[model samples]
Target: MEDHQLSKSLQSIGKSCFVKNFELFSDAAISDLDAMQFLMDDQGYEQTGARTRVREGRRIIESGRAKDALKIIADARLEDSTLADKAYRLSL
Candidate 1:
């Protein structure tokens, strides 16, 4: 499904389901997670959601799900252009 549609469909789902479905989203996964976080922050749930996201990202990395963890990092990099640029450089 398209990202927007996927987001709409995911509105009531749990975060684990949301992250698991990220695979179907491919490149748009980052944007979808951003929008989810934005909606949470807009409702004043920022810190909790951010903490969970960070913890989950770290868990995925430490568990050796490196490539999947890249989705989380890439999603997060939207908040840090320098990190995104550094990642791009590293990738090259």
Candidate 2:
């Protein structure tokens, strides 16, 4: 992944952008993604499981923690959350 992916994500924030390209990751980009995920999660608004997982997994991937993210998905698998979906199983 590269900065362009993150840049696209930045553009997609707030308003929904359906034509998003695949997200790419950089070593230090994870922290930014963590904040984004936090914003999505800490909202008083409720989101669907898919939404939460997408946000969270983006953080995991951008954080350069794909290997660690596998553990999170494994743990969350039983809950049948979006994280357990095949796409995120490997944190891609």
Candidate of highest lDDT: 1
lDDT (Cα, 0-100) at 58 in candidate 2: 62
lDDT of 1 at 2: 41
Worst 10 residues of 1 by lDDT: 5-14
TM-score, each model?
A: 0.29, 0.29
Question: On residues 1-91, what C-alpha lDDT tens digit does candidate 2 reach at each position?
Answer: 3445444433333212111112422234545445445445554333453354456446545556555434433454344354355324444
Q: Write the per-residue lDDT of candidate 1 for residues 1-92, one digit (tens) a residue.
A: 34353333333333343344334333333554564565365544465665454444334334444343334334553545655444334333
Q: Residue 44 error for model 1, in Å?
A: 10
The CA lDDT of each predicted structure is: 0.42, 0.40
Those runs of model 1 whose alpha carbons end farther than 4 Å from true positions after fitting are 1-45, 71-82, 89-92
